[model samples]
Every structure is written in C-alpha cells, then in structure tokens.
Target: MDISIVLNLHDEAEYVSKTLESLEQAMVYAVKRGVQIELIVVIDNEKDDIGTIVEQFNFSVPSKIIKVKNCSLGPSRNDGISLARGEFVAVADGDDLVSANYFYDSFVFIKKLEKNKDRVIVFPEYVMHFDRFCFITKFVDSDQFSAEDFAYFNPYP
Candidate 1:
C-alpha cells in the first residue's frame, strides 16, 4: 500500500464523521491517481457510536477499528502505527478536518522522497479553527531542523 492514515479518536463522536468526510474527499483525489491507502481508526470508546457511523462510510480502502479503554494519545497512536501496513503512515486527529488535497499531495511528495532512507517533510500552511473563527498560518522558508538544533533552538519561541 502507499499510505496508511491512522486517526486517533476519543469521545469526539460528534466530530469524527466530519473528519472522516474530509478524508473521503482526499481519498477521491488519491483514488484518481491510483495511490493505495488505508484508514486505521484507534478509538478508546467502544460505546461512543462512532464505530456505527464509521461502518456506514464506504471507504475505498480497507479500514480497521482498534478498541481500547482509557488509552493515552501516545499509546493509541503507537498502536495504530504498529498496525499500519503501508509504506507511509499519516496521523490525523479525529476532530480535525484535513484539506481535500492532503492525501493526494502527500502521496505524490512521498513518492519522490521514497528514494531517500529517512526524512520528514513539513507542509508550509496549516489551518487552525476556533469556535468562532479560523486562521491559516503559513511558514515561509521553513528549514528542516536536526536533533542538535532542537537542543539549542526553542521552536515555539
């Protein structure tokens, strides 16, 4: 497979559907380009009704639901990654909405970088949505920092 999308969900039943829909939109683009993808949702709440809703979505790729109880984000994500069968794994939060081009664009980019052994590419823009508004933040000329840079540079600052 080309990519495996791991979505970590808690009790955000109301928002999971929207997130899934956004993914479906991205999947449309990916399908056109013939990029293989899978959806892995690691949910902590079995009774949250999100599973029932997820079952309704006819995802082109295979999907898996891992049910756990009171799991932390790190462990849940780790579990999802462990189960991933794709060459690349993309992580998404259950309540967040992704752009329509996210999967397709990333798949293309990954194909180019697949020649290299290890690398991390960060996108320049991200949209932050609040209760009343949303803002798009773009990082111009962002450079890839190394482990040594992390020791000296305060990224948040």
Candidate 2:
C-alpha cells in the first residue's frame, strides 16, 4: 500500500528549501520502514525558478512537480486528488516540517484497525512556533464530518 504526500505550496521560496530537506530526510526513514511515498508537489506559485532549487536538492523521493499558473490550496489539492493513485492520502504545508516517522507510524496504525479498514486519517501533532515559543497541537478526534470542515477558502489571484 502506497501513500501520497500532497505538498501544497505557493510562493514559499523563503522556506521551501528547508521544508524539502526535512521531507527528504523523513522519506529516508519512512522508506526504511517499508513505506512507498509518492510526493505530489503542487507548485501554485512560479515554476521556472523553482526548478533551480528543486533540481539541485538531493532527494530520492519519486516526485511529480505540478506547476499551476495561479491556484489556491483547494484547486491544487483537487488537482492532486484527481491523479492520486495511493490507497491513502496525507497533506503537509509548504513551510511546515513533518516528523521523520510520520509515514511509518501512520501506515502501521491504519493497518491495525481492522474495523476502520480504509478510514485512516491521522494528522500529526502540529509543531507550532510562535514569536518565542514552540509547542505541539494534536489532531482532534472528530465529533462529526461536516462539509464546512473541509470547505475551500478564498482563492489566490
């Protein structure tokens, strides 16, 4: 069973390199645990110069860089959703750094729940960083699934 890391990014040139590095490093750990990761990087920002860094970055992640003109996270995610070929889906922001064992742990947990066969949606405990503080925010066990919960926000120009 494979997983798709739907990385949604806009003009994140400032911090994308570091994010990519962290993801690449995490992929190494995830792979060692027998997880096949497919990176769906949606570049809603610029594509031309983004390649300069993307190509130079050394990572073995099987990535398909989708360069969209001017799309928001909703459209970007929808686009990726259309082509997703994995059994499960996970999302990460452009600036956020995911844990090295994110995929490893998720895969194991999902397989354990025989009852919840395909309802494996485990978002990580967010590593929030404020002005001079940092902490983790865990995913809330949903009370219910409403359309508003996953509703699309305003689009980009």
Candidate 3:
C-alpha cells in the first residue's frame, strides 16, 4: 500500500458518518490517481456507536477497524499506526473532514521530492476551522520557518 490513514475516534458517533464519507471521497480520488490507500479506524470508546457507523459505511480502499479501551487520543492513534501497512501513514480525527483531493495532491507533492521524501512531512496548506470558531488559516511550508520558530509556536497541527 502507498498510504494508510489512521482515524482515531473517541465518542464521536455524531460525526463519524460525515468523516467517513469525506474520507471515502478522498480515497476514491487518490485511487484514480494511481495511489494505493488503506484506512485504519481506531475506536477508543466502546460505549458509543462509532463502530456501527463505520461498519455501515462503504470504503473504496482496504479498511480495518480496531476497538480499544485506551480512552486517550495519543495511544489510540498509536494503536492504529502500529497496524498500518503502507509506505506512508496519515493521522486523522473522526470528526474531521478532508478535501477530496487531499490524498491525491499529497502523493503528487511527495513524488516530487525524489530523494528526501522519507524525511519530509506533508501538511494541508489551508485549515478551515468551524463549529466554535469559523476561520481559515494557511500554513507556511517547512522551509519557510526556522528551528527557533517552533520554540514559539507549532506550525503543524
């Protein structure tokens, strides 16, 4: 597999369906571009209906569901990442929705960096925040920031 998306969830039953739909669209776009993709869903809350929502959704790529009692996002993400079989792995939240071109565009960018691809990390150029606050922010490329910049703030989220 070329990419494995690890989606971590904790009591996000209300939003899992939309998230899955967005992911499926992105997966289809990536597959059409000849990028192999897989999805790994980690459910940290067994009391919720997130698992049922995931099971009912149709995915275009190979997908796996992992139920865990970790209760913490960090460990839940770790569990999903551990099962990833792709050359590249992406971490996603159950309540987040990504653009349909996210995966395809990312793979195109990675292919351009023929030599240092392994050392690079790709982040969305624009992040749209909603619900509590509504705004969109454009992130600076890695080369645009210095090491000292990280000491003050994080450029990647």
Per lDDT, the best of the predicted structures is 3
Native-to-model Cα distance after best TM-score fit, residue 78 in candidate 1, in Å: 1.0
Candidate lDDT values, in order: 0.79, 0.73, 0.87
Q: Residue by residue across 4-29, what tens digits does model 3's lDDT show?
A: 99999888788888899999899999
Give model 2's TM-score versus the native structure. 0.77
Could you tell me how far off, in angstroms, the CA of residue 72 lies in candidate 3 after the best superposition? Answer: 1.2
Candidate ranking under lDDT, highest first, comes to 3, 1, 2
Q: What C-alpha RMSD separates each model from the true structure?
A: 3.0, 5.0, 1.7
Residue pairs with colliding backbones in model 1 are none
Per-candidate TM equals 0.81, 0.77, 0.90
Q: Which stretches of candidate 2 lie over 4 Å from their true place?
A: 47-49, 114-118, 130-138, 143-157
Candidate 1 or 2, higher TM-score? 1
lDDT of 1 by residue, 1-157 (tens): 8888998988778888888989888877887889888889888755578878877778877889888775688988998999999988988887888788888888777677866854766452655654566565544433565557668875432
Q: How displaced is residue 119 in candidate 2, in Å?
A: 1.8
User: How many backbone clashes does every candidate have?
Assistant: 0, 0, 0
